[model samples]
Target: MNPNMTPNLMAVLPTLIIMVTGMVVLIGDSCLKGWKSTKSLSAIVTLIGIAAAGFFALSRITEDSIIVFGGAVVIDSFSNGTALILLATAAFATLLAMTYLENKNLNLGEYYALVLFSTSGSMLMASANDLIVLFIAIEILSVALYVLAGFARTDEKSEESALKYFLLGAFAAGFLLYGIALIYGGTAGAAGNGGTTNLTLISEFLRHTNGVANPMLMAGIALLLVGLGFKAGLVPFHMWTPDVYEGAPTSVTAYMAAGAKIGAFAAIVRVFNAFIPISPYWLIALQVLAVLTMFGGNLLAIVQENVKRMLAYSSIAHAGYLLVGVCAMAGNPRAHDTALGAILFYLFGYMLVTMGSFGILIWLSKRGHDCTTMNDLKGLAKTDPTAAYTMLIFMLSLAGIPLTVGFFGKLQIFNASLMAGQVGIAISMAVASIISVYYYLKVVWTMCFQEPDGNTVEGRATSSFGVNVTVGLSAIGCVLFGILPQTLQFLINASNSIMRP
Candidate 1:
């Protein structure tokens, strides 16, 4: 191994802190016996750890890139920014879990521990410099998620969600591993060395040999895309998303929706940025995938009666929108800063909006009422104006309506796409957003215009305090960032870091 390439502790401290926090929660939970609600202590621990990690990450928000752990991980503005986003997702989800699980009878120490583990895995994925490290991170995130999906053991649907996710996730891992092997074989041979999984080394080898036209390398790239495509909820690999999101506990669903997408896209950016030499070979395929995902996800969401499933499809559509920025970044060698900035901003917006949407579900839920379907939300405006208005903002944001975070995010992404010469995809994305408005507005019309269905809960006087905090923060984030995104200038630095030499 190259000595200069040795791993540095400072570089990975954030992820390490998160991992250590999970271990402590696990050990603490096992040793201390207390009221079921007291298990929320685990959540408290998890939040502190996440905030610490975020602090460490923010402290290192430099524009220059710094590789560590033999280049298996990197510390840069991009990594740090992404780490903050992951931490925020974990924090908000943990907060929601505090009250959410207590009500559902699923509150346990292990639940918070799993969330920390999953979030740390996502943090790893964001900074990974090697394909092997990325794969390991993916597994770490996926395994924790499988368990969290079914944490509500009494629910058959939750169990089913866990099973399906595991099976499909295993296959996707296979695809990624195989792709890594192929890239290694194809490039390492050219370098007269044994196969390696370090992305930088592979990129260097390919660049020296002008390997863009090499078939084996192309095959590997395609396979890697396939694997990542699944995690990002892109088309053809998205079958697992709806069932998983709808079946999993609402808090877990919120976690998966944002955390998973951010991590997957973070990896996608790293891989494609490394493979910029082979842009022609992969750009068209990716563009096609983006188009299919956007149209397909929106069309499917329009027909769904279940709000959770609609959000599932909506998540897929948002994934497609993000893909537009990814594809654009991959194609525009000189425009990565703009492309990445847009992608980062969009993810931030989507995270808050999606989290708030599901956070509302967690807030309104009763033991017998999941608050899942459209009918369940009828006349929600009449009984709970705050919840109704909150949902309205979330809905408008998702629909990309003017002045909402979602709208600005979409605007930035489309601007980036056009700058990258992806005019066709940009136009397609607009149409899909317009089409999405129908369903999004359908949600608004249902909650505002429709009468109360008997299905709506008499409502809870005292839901978990954590959920209210999550809802309030999410609501504030959506509008605050939408109106005054100047607060997010760190993201610009973060995006710029990824484009550095």
Candidate 2:
């Protein structure tokens, strides 16, 4: 073995482990013909793989930044922390997928493998230090998700969602690649540094230039923002979110809402932190996007009768809240530690609520039936108290009620924005949060106060033990994290110490 290759392999051990495990799962599925249950085994293997990756990532927590593959990737605390969260989300999503797929007769080995690959791609994207590598990582993730979204090939809505997502995703990738090319050209002409595509080098160049903004660089940054904004489900680029979430399998939707957001935000942090000196230009653009996304998402959510689609709009609104933290980080790079901390905490809380909400939906949906509308949930509390209570916890948390994780998450971002002196934005965020309460509570009212539609069977939630566990864990996590945020605060601080610039 080459001596130099060993160290590089060690640095990327987590990604390698996931990739290899995915291949093994594929092979195992082919070999285990007429097995009792391939879905259960697949979920177990995926969970074990993610746990191993998390362990490996934690082992490197104390190690300084280790650049791999000639600076294409960099392993640091920020990347490691984000990787852990991605793995955790993927693991939970796999469990939920297994239960839901089995119920819907859609269980397949390929689903588990695809989830692992997508998660690995997200981790790679988070750690990537080179523009080309980031683009490649994103494609790996997007391709897997597109296929997953259309896994129910027989469903017309699923097929339509997949097509729309693929076309728009491809278009966004083109813009991102063009932006990279522009940045390369500008750097090559000005500094003669062989058209450096490394983010660190570009940041250093900008810092030394004393605020001399390049038109090419500015254009590149704008395109890059557009691409990332689409992935993060921000407004003007979030048209795909509601349709896709409504059409996709509930389990896949949960994964997208949690894991995808985590990966996108991770990349946003890496890019913004490395290119801090030129953030003023992007800050203004993000400010406008944030406002539009916040108000638009909430307004659209209020009008949505479909629960899944409403949650999609709610996800967009949460992304807007996250952007507030991103804006603060951009405005004062020196204070990015707090902003980063807040973003991580918010994501953790958001993941629990999102997963719980979707899991309950899966529980309520029968094999041939889709429970997408709020009307489907009318009188759910009277029919199935357990699932209804779980959903209530999710809704309350999502609405930022006290004693729920979502409340603390919003508080963190609001405090960060206030610290950054964004008073108007902060106040608008508060008003948006209030607007959000109306729709979220509408679901609660339907469950508790409204009569049953009389067309559907009752007690749909009583049969699934696996879903019960998932929902219970998520609801409990929401309350625990909300009441005692210091645990997450400590983790955030630890993550910040390793990622500080």
**Residues 289-396 of candidate 1: C-alpha lDDT, one tens digit per residue:** 999999999999999999999999999999999999988886555556677988889999999998899988877787756878888788888978888899999999
- For each candidate, give its TM-score against the true structure: 0.96, 0.96
Candidate lDDT scores, in order, read: 0.87, 0.84
What TM-score does structure 1 among the candidates reach? 0.96
Clash pairs (backbone) in predicted model 2: none
Regions more than 4 Å wrong, model 1: 1-7, 33-39, 190-192, 460-462
Candidate 2 local distance difference test against the native = 0.84
